[model samples]
Target chain A: MDPLLYDILVALGLGLLGAVLFSAIGLISGTDETTTIAPVTLLVVLLGAPPAGVFTFWMCAAISKHMTHAVPTALLGIPGDTMALPLLQQASALRNLGAPHIALRKMLAGSVISAFIAVPLAVLFAVILAPFGTYITASAPWLFIAASVLIAYFSAGRWASVIALVPFTLLIVALQSFTGAHEVKLGVSYFLGIAIGPLVAELISAASPLERKRMNRSEPRETTLAPDVKGWGGYFPNPFRVLDRSQVRATATAAAITSGTFVFSPVAMTVIAGEIVGARIKHAYHRLTSVLAVRNGVTESTYIAEALIPLIAFGLPLSPVAAGPAAPLFNAPPRFTVNSETGVVNNLHTLMSVSEFLIWGLVSVVIATLIAYPFAMNHARSAAAFVAKRISHEAIIATFVGLILVIGLWEGGVIALLVILTVGLVGGLLYRVLGMNTGVQFMGYYAAVLSVPAILKLLG
Target chain B: MNNPTPAPASGPDGQLAEIWGDVVSRPQLGKAILIGAVVSLAVYAVALATIAPLASTPAIGKALAMLAGIIGCILGGAICARLFQPKRRVVEQIAPGAIWQTEVLDQIAIEGGAIGSVEDLPPAVAQEMREVGLYSVFQDYEQDRARNREAG
Candidate 1:
């Protein structure tokens, strides 16, 4: 057997495995990307998979998850993850217009198209940015703070998000110190805290008498599953056939633009790209549907771009998505480490070249498209129906809660659990009340770790 | 004429302004934002004084100071949210009759040059499809797919 051929086969298999696993997981609503993805990728790395296997598996999972995450958001009006938030408005709007099936097809088709574009564009952008990695890295701390503030300001909460960042960053630093004192440095639990904050807040509210009274609905929430429209003329029915000319153009253009700029938040990119598309569209019906397509496409494009560009260009986690959800790829410690202060990088940068990233990224996209696109196209109605009817929201929340508990205990036993509660309670309440979402909270987490110290030193 | 609700203002592009364009003019939002800023700054001051002493390193000190600031901001946010009195307004911008997903797909097939007609349909239904951009000769699957690929 040829060794090179053997490696390619194994990587393809690994990528397929990841795509299959996450495409199904993507159907379960309220699953946070960072909380679920970071841990799973970390586990794959720890299990001592080959470099290709690790990269393909991670990339495949990320691509596949974003594609199918539109399921719940478009069908049930519940977000599949944080990135799926912006699509909820358009999805619900489509649903109210009695066309969730159409929304699902458009979203899935957009993901397939965007994922195809994002891989090559992200590689090209990374190559262009590679030469400036050192200069960019040296100024990471101040950059993160400035970026955090800017992102917070643009968040739906707007100025309120900016103000909330003060307390959020402070809270993260306080918790890190409290845990660090116990010699158990924490990271993933903090993410899970912010990720599941809303759930915990709702549960807490359910316990209060007055709040429980307010929480009670007169009837169970209703979900309407629209009839699945068969393809114009085909047995397999290619997903792309469902979208219009302008939709395809808008989505591709948006995906290309988003794939290159690896600096901003994914939510911000989604909004900006969607706005760019929406502003130019003239028809009312077309504008609504086209914006939905572009926004969902932006989700896939931005995630791939954020991960690949930073991974390939700097070999360091510079972008928020890289620093947050995709951190395991760059710095899972003893196994992979890229120290900001010492200029020590022993991660993908050293392990893989730009060509390898390009090849493997394309492989991941192909695998994800094979698994997610056809399934989403063919079974959009049944899948949406299954998720809305069978998957209990409590069970999903409980599953994540259990995962967070084990992770917390794994970090520092009882103290880590306390940290999770403190962060989740405060973070959740702040989010619920102020509308400051998980994206800004993630930025706040980064600020606490990187920026707060820099600010302190400058003052000193 | 009793309750004449003017249609939403249109942009230069002819698309209606966002559904929430009216809510943006609410005077209460400005007041809430001002309160929020004042509260955040005061919290920053108190946090700096209180958290500066508990740190072991410059990084730790700065982080602690941030923690203090976060605590202040949360308190302030809660107060402001209460003061603002959030309410819900169900704005129905798109009517069900306006959404024609099937017609859109028909238009796509025709624009991609897959077919010239919505075959076996009434003249009215065919006209609706044509109005949405579905009037072209049927082309091969490969040609249509290729055309859409380039557009996409």
Candidate 2:
């Protein structure tokens, strides 16, 4: 068989797998992208998938999840994931106005259109920036430090998150040395710990007597699942028909503009894009629907740009999205790695060429759109209801717990498990108290690995 | 054999708490977590003992074992799902009435949005609203606002 044909086949297979898997996962709320995508993509890399396969898998998974995530956000008034939170107000308003289906369709159409627009634009932006890749990699240590501070400042905690990075970096350094003494070097454990920090904090808080009153619930929570209306005839609804002319134009423009601003937080970008678009529309109904469309569109575009730009341009996890959910593509060790001292990279960036990235990137998006978009459109109400009624939160928690244990032990051993616990507890508490979210914590991890070494050498 | 009124129930495994983002019975959550850890670890241990020696590369063997362990995690979750139900009251919402639609529009206006007149909408948008049966709703709301302004 031709090697090129084999690579495409592998990429398509993995892309389909990722799309199908994550589309289901997206229906369950509170599954953060970093916590879910990073570890799974890491598994793919470590399992010795081809570089194209790995890249396509991540791209398809991210796109598919974003598309289907609108289901719960529109129908149940619950955010499908962190990215869906900004769209909830519009979704809920539409739900109250008895047109949640409109909100859902608009979001789906926006995401599909934006994803198509974002891919080519992101690749173009990345190519334009690719000439500076060598310089970026050489000064990666200093860049990591500066990027950490900038990302932290932009986090919800603002100055508090910026101040919190010091302790967080120190904590990681201390743990590294402690494990180094035991002849155990762990990387995935730390990622797992930071990714699952919020859950760890919540579990601990639930166990504490002091937090019992806050954590306790006397009755089950109530959620009003709105009735869905099918406005389209067939399974594959045309996005152009779903959105009005103004909405399509707004979504495309927002997606194109946001594809260049990849360094900022995706949530912030989504909010700002929606605000700008919403403020321009005069009618209240149009404002609500248009904002939903644009915000969801921005979510897709921002993720694509943030992940693709750094991967193509610099081969570094520079953006918040790159550092968090897409970290494995840049720095999954052994199979893929970014050397802390030398700033050397051996990941998809080195393995695949620029043309391959573009080709495979678009291929993954098309695969995701085919599998997730229509499924979400046709079976959203049933899927949402099935997940809500059948899948217990306890089951989800149990799965995560199993993941933590398995990944920790697989990485090193008991020592690695202990490292995960320590990092998770501390990082989780800091995130809870200071609003230094997972993205900032991920940047802090990079700082500990990259910047701390540079600072020590300078002092010496 | 039964009394007319049962004695007040004690706190025997009736502790409900919100963990992560959803509510769960505390005792059941504890059991679920235990099952998750035990099942996954047990699978990993067994795979290491059985599969590690047979594989050509130790790393590949370990990776395969981790995959099995992840599957074990999902299996454990499935078991828990079968055992425990979700702690949520899911109410299927009915179609909202005109009054509720007006209230929602009012709330949107209060949030600094412009409730523009239906007559000013573009053709495509007006067609969309008509298809969704919201064109008359918006037009009526605009008339009501106009009447109130004149009366005032």
Strongest candidate by lDDT = 2
Residues A151-179, candidate 1: write the lDDT tens digits: 67766688999999998899889888877
User: Which pairs, if any, clash in model 1?
Assistant: A167-B70, A170-B66, A170-B67
Candidate RMSDs in Å, in order, are 14.3, 2.8
TM-score (0 to 1) for chain B of model 1? 0.43
What TM-score goes with each of the models?
A: 0.71, 0.97
Lowest lDDT 10-residue stretch of candidate 2 chain A: A225-234
Q: B1-152, model 2: which lDDT tens digit per residue?
A: 87886343224437788888888889899999999899988998898889877889999999989988999899899989998899888999977899999998889889888899888889989899998888888899999999999999
The CA-based lDDT of model 1 is what? 0.68
lDDT of 1 at A76: 65
Off by over 4 Å in 2: B1-13
Residue-level lDDT of model 1, residues B64-131, one tens digit each, is 55444444444554565445432222222233442354444345445432323234443443343344
**TM-score value, chain A, candidate 1:** 0.88
For model 1, the superposed segments whose C-alpha errors exceed 4 Å read A1-10, A77-79, A88-99, A232-236, A338-340, A453-460, B1-152
Local distance difference test scores for all models: 0.68, 0.92
Error of 1 at A112 (Å): 1.2
